[model samples]
Target: MKALTTYIISQTKLPEVSVKNTIELLNEDCTIPFISRYRKERTGNLDEVQIGDIVKFKEQFEALEKRKIAILKALEEQGVLTPELKQKIEATLDLTTLEDLYLPYKKSRKTKAETARQHGLEPLAKIIMSQNANDVESIAFKYVKGEIASVEDALEGARHIISEWINERTDIRNNIRQQLERFAMISTKVVKTKADDENAQKFRDYFDWEESLSRIPSHRLLAILRAESEGFIKTKIQIDDDKALDKIESRIIRSNNECSEQIQIAIQDAYKRLLLPSLSNEALQIAKTKADESAISVFAKNLKQLLLGSPLGEKRILAIDPGFRSGCKLVCLDAQGGLLYNETIYPHPPQNDSMGAIKKISSLTEAYKIEAIAIGNGTASRETEAIIRKIHFKNEIQVFVVSEAGASIYSASKIARDEFPNYDVTVRGSVSIGRRLQDPLAELVKIDAKSIGVGQYQHDVDQTKLKKELDVVVESCVNAVGVNINTASASLLSYVSGIGPKLAENMVSYRDENGAFTSRNDIKKVPRLGGKAFEQGAAFLRIKEAKNPLDDSAVHPERYDLVKQMAKDLGKSVQDLIGNAETLKKIDLKKYCTESVGLPTLQDIIKELEKPGLDIREQAKVFTFNQNIKKINDLHEGQLLPGIVNNITNFGCFVDVGIKESGLIHVSNLSDGFVKDVNEHVSLHQQIIVKVLEVDVPRKRIQLKLHT
Candidate 1:
């Protein structure tokens, strides 16, 4: 345990006490958001990222220890556990080194070496290995028995045993691994059968490509590997064969005699049959794991930005899922996102009933008091927008084109089915588009993160790892903005600090049976919700119109008495202290600091009082695309257009320029100077102007340069 603590501290470069405290908190089953937000004093105010690192490293070290125990037990059962071997295994932290040490003792199927030993050639093999045998042929002749027909046969058997011995040597394996890591090249070739397939055209760039394994970017690696998985290309890791052989020969050969000649044969066999294949696979696996981590990190970052994008607040929205031949599915949602009405309008092709659609829209807008219109950016979306614009509404209504990337997926999900048992998929989808404009975080939590489509190669990365990383991001975002206790659905509440799916269901069920929660303390009455759950989750759950205004803010329930005392000290009520910026500015944070609540927590409390239950997210604004250029063919070179950054990767960002196909803004064109990271230049959903550099009509590719 001490060694594990030391290792985590060294890897994270964090204070030892803080690491230890975080480990203790995690061991006590506290979630990362809980520890980061509430347990600031114990963790030295380490944020969620730092705490997440601690958790990851601790899990890795624990897994390594488990492997060590299994290896030790195996060696003991095999009756080969010497004190020296056991000590080496116990003291080493590197998994590769430990595996190398245990290779000789590991059980395997019968091999050439075992066959030679079974035929009574062990003595002859040892004599040759000593490198002191003169007249090795005569020495080998003496060991001729069953399976050993002549002097040549005996010598061949001896060589085979020596080859296996060299392969198992710890020094030899380690040296070969290092060489492969430093000089290996990854190369890919298109499979002949798949060369002409249309599906394989996307990987043409990698069909005849070679790059240094250590220097290839994460995206390229994932792309090539994905192509290989789909049978479009074959990949191989290559190193200089001569250099590798020379290094191994130098380590094994110590003399220049007949015995040395035999050893050289063994070395060649070892290099070809054992070391190269094993280490090349190891190197590729290492590279693949690294690529997976990088891709998952990128996905998590993009997902965080997209989930926390600006919200339209609680507005009465009229959402439309537009289609050409099928007309448009429209639904009206109240301020809290409850579906008040739904119907279809044929403002587009086939049934172009423009007058009827306009009358229906205007009457519905006035009947439900619609404040905004959210139109899905799909087929006939532009025509639908034009129809809505043509209508003269009684009042000003803002119209927004919302991305409908995963609305269909959400509508077909079981959660959606349960939410709207009587509504069809179209109605549910329109409702999703409306609610997304209202609050992206709340609505997005109900769908799978992968369905949101902000990721790169999301389906190809490690699924378990990607899911874990994305779940953490969602949790962080949810807790960052906080959830309304009375209005939050089971899906949104499930992401709060310590509450999970079961508890979330329980809370909703409890709410349905009783009325709305009037205070944060009332949440404890839910079945199976204990003291610890309340302590971890109470701060992130907001209750509007509560008796104590602190219940609606981020201030934890544990600090309520302290806040009351502060208000009493100021000779004012709690309500008077809250939202009174002048009074809050005069309070000395140092005077309120305690052993558990430091200056950081005190400052946070003061900020919370200044604006209780404040949202950090910006309000959503209306964006206009180039009305004249609605399709790809309409674009020309050097034409400046308005676009929104839809996705970001290591290479560049893809911007939606109000067309079916998005344009690529390469990293080189992101800025006037060197741009190391594309994210530093633009974020997901950021509106910017770009100039069309070139357009490949045949390939449907658009090259764009960002304008400052």
Candidate 2:
């Protein structure tokens, strides 16, 4: 118990308040969301992930402590537990090391050790190990009983016992493993099989390559291991066997010539039979596990970057999902993403007349004040853009071809179908593509984030762990953006703090039964959303109209009264005081600060009021460039190209420059200065201008540069 607590303390490095609060909340069976909200002061405002990690680690420690106690009790019952052994076991920090130390006392498989013990040759084995045997044959012959009739038989039986003794020494094995791991090289070669001896189709590139164990990249190691497992390659590591034997003899066996030779053979035999299999498998597993960890980390990082990518804010947009067979499905939405009009037009079809498409565009733009057109970049997307560009309207509206990677997924989803029951799937997809440009957070929540395609090695990583981590990232992003209570569907609302499927359904039902909720107070009237749920969720829920003006602001409704009092103290109405530049310029927030409203809290309130729920979406910057580049070969070195960052990986960022392919800006070319993490340099969907550095059309590779 003491060791468990110490490990937790050492590993977390969490403040005392956080440690105590996490333990207490975990003890109370409170969920991560509940603790993050209701017990913020106790946990020092630890976020959900930190709380979850602490809980998981603490649970592991408790389980290990229970197992440790059980092991001690079992050994005591067996009457073989010495005080020194007990103390050593208690002091062991890692469970793996402790179990290795106790391997001799644990149950054994049907092995040479058990067979030798049955033949009563263990005493002779120990005597030989003592190395006082001036005559080695004479010493072993003494243990020759009925079963062990000859010196050769007795010696053979004794070797088995000695090998077990060597294998049981945890300290020796641990040392040898460390040495081999550092000194060995993993070599992989294509298998020379009768099926395809010279061809080596699967492992052609890796037919002859060797990497030092310590220097091998995780991905490369996994690739080789997988290739070998599939029978496409042969892989093995070469170690200094003589060095290993010498080390084992120095540590365990006595320094006598005859005993040393026998012990060396025994150690070598044990290594081949026991240690090699265990250590090699362990090394490979470690390599694979590290690779998986790296893959998971990259995926999680990419997911977070994608989920939190800047939204485009609210804007009047005309969305069009282009198709050759079905024609084009057009949907118009206002600044708030409420569907205003929907229709289908065949611009490039049997009719082939531009008049029909022009008339539809002009009517929609005039009727809905369409400021921009978000066309899906699918089949006929460019052709659709060309048709729209020729049309004449009152205002000059910009046209953008959206990625539309997961638009169909969102359109076919249950949430999308629920939201737009009257519309066809194509119409729904058009609306999704348009709304994604308007507010990515509100629209993207309907689709699985994985389908959005901003992950690295996602398919190969642990799917369960990857899903859990990505789901958490999605939830954090959703809550951080703050969903619109009225327009948000149940799927979106479920991501809100303290709201799940049932409560979200109840909320939608209540909203439907009773019009849009105008204030945070109305949430309590929803069925099953009691006081505790309200207390946890009310802060994040915003209302356009409320008695207390701060409710419309990001300032939680719980702090509404205090903000109102401060406004009143300054002889100003709460509404006029918050966003009013003239009044806000005159009033200093420091004058109204109290014990509850520290400098941090006061500054946050001031900032919140300055821009209440300020959307972090970047305004789309329109660029007009020459449509001259069609193929990769038409590019020249140092040619400036406008592109959008499609994805960012550890090595580089992929930029889509309106071509058939994407170009890579290696980590080296990201900037003139050294870069550690890619996100710090570039993020998802960021429109950047880069210069082409190299292009290999045969390999379909393009190297780009962001630096001038």
lDDT agreement with native, every candidate: 0.92, 0.76
Q: What clash pairs does model 1 have?
A: none
Question: In candidate 1, what are the lDDT values of residues 1-708, reduced to their tens digit?
Answer: 689899899789999999999999998889999999888899999999999999999988898899999999999999999999999999887888889898898899999888988898878888888999899988877877677889998988888999889889988888888887899999999999999999999899999999999989999999999999999999999999888889888987889899999989988888888888888999998998899998888889899999999999999999999998888999999999999999998877788899999999999999999999999988888778878888999999999999898899999999999999999999999999999999999999999998899978989888999999999999999999999988899999999998999999999999999999999889999999999889889999999989999999999999999889889888989899889999988787788887888987888888999999999899999998888887889999999999999999888999998888999999999999999878899999999999999999889999999997
Q: Taking the tens digit of each residue's C-alpha lDDT, what string does model 2 give over 35-128?
A: 6644566777787778877876787677667777988888888898999999888877677677776778886578987888899988878877
TM-score of 1: 0.97
For model 2 the local lDDT of residue 438 reads 76
Candidate No. with top TM-score: 1
lDDT of 2: 0.76
Taking all chains together, each candidate's TM-score versus the true structure is 0.97, 0.84
The candidate maximizing lDDT is 1
Error of 1 at 77 (Å): 1.3
Find the 10 residues in a row with the least total lDDT in model 1. 138-147
Relative to the unseen true structure, what is the C-alpha lDDT of residue 447 in candidate 1, on a scale of 0 to 100? 90
